[model samples]
Target chain A: MLSCEQATRLTSERQERSLTLRENTELKMHLFICSGCREFGRQMDALRSLIRRQPGDKPPED
Target chain B: MIPDSDIADLRRDMLAFARLQISDPHLAEDAVQEALAGALKNAAAFARKASLKTWVFAILRNKIADLLRSKYREPVTTTDPDCKHCAPADDQYFDDNGHWQQDTQPRSWGDTHWLADNADFWKVFDACLNDLPAEQARVFMMREFIELTGPEICATLELSSSNLHVLLHRARLRLRACLSGQWFGTEESA
Candidate 1:
């Protein structure tokens, strides 16, 4: 199983590129048992959501 | 037909947007003015397929891109800030060889308490972003707000893939920590 730090690295990495099958499998397995890294992933998603809704999120007119 | 009110709104929003990317108030205003003027010149060509806001923003994005390219015309040495937020220091979040630290693990911020819509939330958001190192923030905005891809960012910024990745990671880490402290500090309310 990947350490929390390594798992987190892969988590951030996935944002820029898709993980390979082996990497994906390892991360998933790690997350299954690791709540901290899981939470870290959730935080990353929350951050993205917040970023997308930033001042320049969409082009207004909604 | 573009309404006068809409143009005014666009100018205000674009100014705020440009200010985030470019530190110079004068240059930021210049970018907005130029974008607005370009839109005016192309008024007849606008097909209205997209919202006027979207169309104008697209033009502004191009203008910002041009400005960035010009400013970085030299063989760019990207300023990769030494992140104070990454590993070793982050050991509390994990254990030796990399297992989660369990007791120090993060909790899910499932409901971010309307931060996605609150105007004040954006203020904090912008402040947090502005707190990052200039170059890190620049790369971040281009990737996140401007939605530029990795290759495009690398080509434009003269960064290697690893450099971009690390810079991006640190940027994300810093932003997350700031928001979690300022916005999500103690809120678990649904």
Candidate 2:
């Protein structure tokens, strides 16, 4: 079992697309069993949604 | 003496990309103009090593950096104290029943209709993006908002894949932490 710190780091890495499959699986497994980490993941998702909504100066076209 | 059509295209493209990096519409416009001027003056140096879009974007990034540096000597911070509720506690996922629980699954989390649906939420959201570390924020904006690919970002920022990944990871994590504080009541002090 990965430590909470290791799981946290891996989860962040996975979110960034920097983690290897092995690392991702380890983190996913850890999350499956750990409520805190699972919550962290959910929060991470919520955060992504919020950031996407942030209005920038760019026009509608790109 | 650049052609008007090319200049128009460049203006449109640069404004779009600049908006990703800069929240201020006026500043983004100014930065795009400055970048176009620099690119035209330095046209002789263009070797076609990268796409014209990438080359232009690199120049725009530099201009944006300069503007940000001048406007805020210190890093940007959140003005909303209420925005602090989004950060997660170490124990937040657990239920009162002592069972491991998740309020929402990650897949369903992509449904951003709720956030996009609210104007007030966006006010705090934009502030959170500004609060991110500058480089990471730049990368995230380029990748996510501007739809730049990894290789394109690597070429533009001159970052290796590993370095880019790390920078992006840090940026996303920080943004997530910041937004969570605002939207989800996760505690900004965390």
Candidate 3:
């Protein structure tokens, strides 16, 4: 099993490029049992979307 | 038809984005203004398929690319500020065994879409982003915000693939920690 550090590293690398099959399988297995790594993965995705939003995009009205 | 308010908004946003990529305020302004003017001049030719903002951003990106090409033609040397081996603070997240440190374990950031649109959240986001080492922030923005391909960024920044990957990885790690500490996992909440 990949450690949290290695799993998280792969999560970030996934953003940059396609992971090999072995890497994909290992990361998926790690994420399945680790809520911390899963949350880390989600946060990374959130960060990407937040950064991609244009500066002009205003907050939705309450 | 593009409304006047929309143009104003796009101009402001474009300038902000350009300034993130280019250090010089004047140069960033110049690129944005030129892009706005070009977009206006060819407004009739704009296809309806893509959002107007996307089209204008493309023009601004082209201008920035040209500026970067001219400004950074010389291959980055070892002495370059970015090339300095500044050790990232991200190592604190993991233990010697490469597991997440007990105190630094990631927690759920509930309702991220809601946070994404929260203006206060964006302020925290910007602060977290700005706190990153300058080159890391710039390269991260280029890769994520500007949608530059990996090869494109390597060529433009004169960075090797490995170097670029490390910068990007560290940037993400730090940003996640900062955002969690400041917003999602605040002392009262976590």
Candidate 4:
């Protein structure tokens, strides 16, 4: 089982790399039972969405 | 075929991206103009597979690179190893067993979409972004707002994946903590 710290790190790591099956399973299992990290993940996603919708700036076509 | 209006739009987007990379407004404008000029010069070589916007943006990315290289050629002082976010944290959330500490567990910030309706939210956001240790802010903007690929950012900034991810992680954590305080209801003063 991944620790809260490790799971949090995985949250940001998802931005740069896709987790492997084992890594994904650990993260999902930890998140399923951990409300704080789950809430933290929700906030992170919401933050990204808001940052994406920031006016006058579209996602650079990459 | 290049339309003058299309050039104008390209310049606008290019300028926006350049402004994030370069501090001086004049320098940003010059970079954008120089990029457009280069694109126009190579107009015949354009494969037409990429959108005009993408083509122009790729050109502008190079232009920004050129300006950074020429205008600031010295060893970079901005990406300090010991900077706040770049350094390892003193207190981590997990104990020896890698489980959560009650005190360090993250707290929730309820529906934060009010940020869209409130223009001032951006003001707070900008301030918070600026408050981040300089290196972290640069990495965050390049990776997120400026939309550089991980490899591209690594090449431009000379960071390995692990180093870059650390900077990005710190940036997100710092920014989220700031928003949770100033924008959400968790501010210490509140």
Candidate 5:
């Protein structure tokens, strides 16, 4: 299993589309065994979805 | 004369780009207007260093920073009630026994659609972005939403590549943690 630090690093790098195949495989392996990191990945995906949904020029309502 | 259609198209594109950098919609509108005006006024000085889009974004970034600096002379507070339970000690939410607490029935990845239909999801998302330290937030916005390359971000922000990476990493980590808390009810683990 990957250490938390390694998993976190992979999580961040995943967003950049910069991870190698070997690195991605390793991250997936680690994620299978690490619930915390898996949860982290889910949250990251959720946040990405939310950010993408943000309207660029709509005013915030009072 | 520039056709009215072209002008409107430019305004729309600039507003979309500015929205990526500045999460606040009104601020994005203002930045887009200012950037469009600047680009027009300085049309003679287009030195071809980058694409027009990149150049326009650089202007928008500066304008957003100036607005943020003015509006937030004091640090913005980070007290959203929705995220109060996401503290580090709240790992119980993700613990083995507690995992089933919230409709724990596992669903296929494609089956989940809450974020798509829920407006509150974005409120929490924007709140998390706003929680980031100003500089970190700026770097994150420039790199991720605006899709600027690392070297470009470093050059634009006057930061070293390593510094830029570190800031981006921290910002992403924080956003991940914050969003997990708000969406998944999971506290950051170590």
Candidate 6:
């Protein structure tokens, strides 16, 4: 089982790149049982959207 | 024709972003000015595939790069091996067994959609972003704000792919902690 520490790291990294199949499975299995890591993942998604929506100055298009 | 107010806003945004990369305010101002000028000169050739803002920022990015190269001898600082601020904060949340420390477990943030229009919330968000260490902030902005690809960032900053990933991950984790503690987990302070 992936530790919360490892799970959270993958959670953060999921923002930057596609995880390997093993990583994705491991993260999914851990998050299924770990509310803390699940909440951590949701927060990561929230932060991404919030930062992107920041008013006044918009980031450049990809 | 883009209104003067819109141009002024873009200039302000460019200057703010430039100042983060270049220490001198005057130099940052000059770079933004030159970028706007260049964008105007080539306005005819601006293919509409990208938003005008994106095109403008692309020009500004190159302008800042030139200035950094000429003045600092490197367009962007590469990773520092022993930099104290660049160290990861993972230990703060996890114990020796790699489980989350009891006090540091993630908390539910409740509804977040309402925050989209909350100006005060943005203030806290900006503060958290600004509080990031310099290198982490740069990479985070490059990846998240500037929308650069991982490979593009590695090329631009001369970072290994692994290093870029680590910096970006660290930045996200820190920002998550800051936002949760300051806004989501507590009653509105702003």
lDDT of 3: 0.76
RMSD (Cα, Å) for all candidates, in order, is: 6.1, 12.0, 6.3, 8.1, 11.7, 6.1
* lDDT of every model, 2 decimals: 0.70, 0.58, 0.76, 0.70, 0.58, 0.73
Residues forming the 10-long window of minimal summed lDDT in candidate 3 chain B:
B77-86
For model 6, the superposed segments whose C-alpha errors exceed 4 Å read A54-62, B1-14, B22-27, B34-85, B186-190
- TM per candidate comes to 0.67, 0.51, 0.73, 0.65, 0.51, 0.70
**Is candidate 1 or 4 superior in DockQ?**
1
Name the top TM-score candidate.
3
Over B141-172, each residue of candidate 2 has an lDDT whose tens digit, in order, gives: 77665555676666555566566666665565
TM-score of 1: 0.67
DockQ of 4: 0.36
Q: List each model's interface RMSD.
A: 5.4, 9.6, 7.3, 6.5, 10.5, 5.4
Better by DockQ, candidate 6 or 2 = 6
Name the TM-score of candidate 5. Answer: 0.51
Candidate with better TM-score, 3 vs 6: 3
The positional error of residue B78 in candidate 1, measured at the CA in angstroms, is 9.9
Query: What DockQ number belongs to candidate 2?
Result: 0.17
The docking category that best describes candidate 2 is: incorrect
Scored by lDDT, model 4 comes in at 0.70
**For residues B1-190, could you state the per-residue lDDT of candidate 5 as single tens digits?**
3456756876786776566555679888987887777765654455442334345655665676565445523432333333322233223223354332242222223323456545576567668888877677778887655556676555554465556656666677676656656655644331
DockQ metric for all predictions: 0.40, 0.17, 0.32, 0.36, 0.13, 0.40
TM-score attained by model 6: 0.70
State the lDDT of candidate 6 residue by residue for B1-190, as single tens digits.
6667877887887888988877888898888887788676655565442355666777677666556545655344566554444565657767998886777777889878778667688678778889887889888876766556777666666676777767877787777778877877632221
